[model samples]
Target: MYIPPSSTSPSAQTTTIMSLKTALISYFTFFVVFVDLTLASKHHVINFRSPTLYPESLTWDPSADHFIVGSHRHRTLVSVSSAAAVDTLISDLSLPPNTTIVGVSLDHHRRRLLAVVHSTPPLPIFNALAAYDLRSPHRRRLFLAPLHDPTTDRPIANDVAFDFSGDAYVTNSVGNFIWKVTPDGEPSIFSRSPAFTSHPVDQSLPHSFCGLNGVVYSRKRLPPRRPIKHRQNVQSQRR
Candidate 1:
């Protein structure tokens, strides 16, 4: 149960939780690798060595024509398509040391990227949200949703995503609830499904935090503005 700390958006004027540890061993008694399979041709299948995935969210950018996958511990997104892995797009994110990610998005628009990172505080221990800069790649910039208080220094962010209208939503594992954070500087409850709370407290791994998958946005549909109050100046006049 480790969370990392994130820097406040220069404009959003908000605090974010982060994590500490960087190794996957913090959540499991034993180290385990993940495996996935897909059939490309009618009679052909292929297997590849993918990271032990912790699905955050996914999206596709028709402009880039790739599917992005976010997981724990890494700062790159798995660029996927109907073909195969083109390349791993790195993100600019300052994550908790030894942090592993589980979420990601694929959009031609927007600047802030989401992923599930795990780490432990005081000694690199955590399990929280890992933010990245889309403009930049593979650079750990800052935590957007810190879990522990800089004073108390004890909090964590589980997972994060944005709704259809660009409302950022996150799973506050510590609070045992999902939060709907409006770009308008407002936060609300999005989901409280028992599945989120039922998760075991021990080095037990998450068994499907819902879609816990990826998000996709077509480049042709890039909103006139970046992402509403999300990527622009925090001072926004609500309609």
Candidate 2:
């Protein structure tokens, strides 16, 4: 089951871990936690009650008034409605056989859904960025941005970010780099330096050998901050 915040409140977006064994309904301003289980029923201001397999990430789509979920076991995306209806938003990306869809984000300005595709098997693991058209449900315009790290054996694409220009930036957890995707869906190396190297000095620390996880870009002039998970950051920039 998946729980998406019913409202846009800051408190609603609080980070939570949904236990796969328990079932409960929570209302957050910006976030919702989905535990592993079968949905009982849908109630007021809440829906998306059902069984889901390997749900990895979710993002709220204000235009469609629904939450988009990515499957870690399947390379697909689905939308859950407040009325307890589930719909297939994207699937059959025609990627490699073992690709899994992990992170998802909405590019409101571009009217597109950006996703990270992690491919397993076929040695020297690589990741790709997928873009889907949001103009209509019937048209499945797919664009791919493939990435790899010549220095590392395994590179995992985790999350995505958009700069002020609407260009997409993706986070590589294991490779310690940020990839930039053009509006046309072309991908290129945006930034990769030794500064992103993870030391893993203390096991007790939340730090992981995977350098970076989540990132955010701002239109304001403020400094940009990237969240280093054990994994995320928001910054303001001038438009």
Candidate 3:
């Protein structure tokens, strides 16, 4: 057996190693290409044009085949179709000047659209919510309400969610609280967690921001399994 140890040449071993390297490179390239194509097929783009409107939040209307966007600049709710048709659903609310709209949600059962409105100027005020009646004949009925918190000074209405019973819940990013609004527009603090509190300004950067930002609700449904209470959670987007 020792006499036949040198039967294979060095060039033959080098060629075999080169073949394996090439095969590995080919497999890696194919995997990357497959993943890229899979992701690309799942998403697409839609475009619209509104010169004065700076959109911050969007919600889709499945019944009408259009999307509603909240304007931060014009302070309006504009509708954009899939074919790029743009129209103003509600021109303006009774809010103050420099009001910016953020999160929006549709209440199908209540036939209303709720939007989070905040003011930007010398002093920013983010404690307002606006509701529009979707079933109105004129299509412009507007209602504005303020969310108040005596414990925390800064209350920014960031996002909104609804439950099975048509009650609305909103997240206050700066105040670290959740507000509940009834169908009649009455607002009260739902929950306040100390976890959303931010550090002192003097101890950190002057522009540091923190608190609860987004909220969502999930309802339990089962035929014979007795009706359970709806569960909700607040998600903070801190900086």
Candidate 4:
């Protein structure tokens, strides 16, 4: 008596209903399953386990055909396969023991994985942008650039975006700014705006201190400006 969400024909509807029935029976039998209805005619379910590994950010690695996820609780990066297998990809020893991995970005062109690492408030100690060599057998640590100055207020390095020129931009949710890391691993504040500080009128809202959580880069070019001759003509007419 189950109904499908959408179907193009009666036969398709019947198939979907049967699939749901089977999935329900499996679920009752103690199997973890979820129906993936990304495609109208196809259904797939994936179940993965990583005890106490609360992931915060995930990115697809097309070359590996799997997902790279950053752990919020474990301070590690792991890869999840289609078959529900999990493998630790990066766990740097240099980072503070209490820090968490917040964001992950894959630079396929440069064969590197970028990550944001920071400690939460109440005694925040570490904040940095880290990189790993994806092509290396050991997944070697490429660099770790601290995003905040020791004299400044503690900032939470949250997420990252990579540009075509090999520059990595990281967001500071606590400081309301962005950090730019060069290809050679130098870190500097890239951007800040007064608008980023403006908050909702409702002060009771949660997590109001957080700002600039995510970032992205676009490669599109702007239209060319009009020729100088056109401006000269207008100025002469004004005279």
Q: Rate the local accuracy (lDDT) of all candidates.
A: 0.51, 0.75, 0.78, 0.85
The segments of candidate 4 whose C-alpha lies over 4 angstroms from its true place after superposition are 1-45, 149-152, 198-201, 222-239
Q: Give the TM-score comparing model 1 with the true structure, all chains together.
A: 0.45
Model 2: how far residue 1 lies from native, Å: 61
Best candidate (score: TM-score): 4
Q: After superposition, how far is residue 89 of candidate 4 from its true place, in Å?
A: 1.0
Better of 1 and 2 by TM-score: 2
- How many clashes (backbone atoms < 3 Å, residues ≥3 apart in a chain or on different chains) does model 2 have? 18
- Residue 18 C-alpha lDDT in model 1: 26
Select the stronger candidate by lDDT from 2 and 4. Answer: 4
| lDDT score, candidate 2, position 59 | 92
lDDT string, candidate 1, 1-239, tens digits? 43333544633333222222323355443333221223332363333346655445566666666667765545556766656654676543555455656545432355656665556445564544445566665534444544332322433455566656666666554555565655443555666678755644544556332332332233365558545465345445342
| Per-residue lDDT of model 4, residues 1-239, tens digit only | 64446634888877878988998897866532333333354755768999989889999999999999998876789999989889998878778876889989999999899999988766457888899999999998889898875434777889999998899999988778888999889999888888887665455778766768989888988899866798789999999
User: In model 1, what lDDT does residue 13 have?
Assistant: 33
- Over 1-239, each residue of candidate 3 has an lDDT whose tens digit, in order, gives 22242676888767777988999999999999999999889855678789978888888888778899998786788899988999888867456777888889988777789988876546565577778888887666455778887765666678898897877899887667889988777888888766666444453755455467777888865558756444422223231
| Cα lDDT of model 2 by residue, 9-56, tens digit | 555454343432233333341233332222434435754643554678
RMSD of 4: 12.8
Instruction: Estimate candidate 1's alpha-carbon lDDT, on a 0 to 1 scale.
Output: 0.51
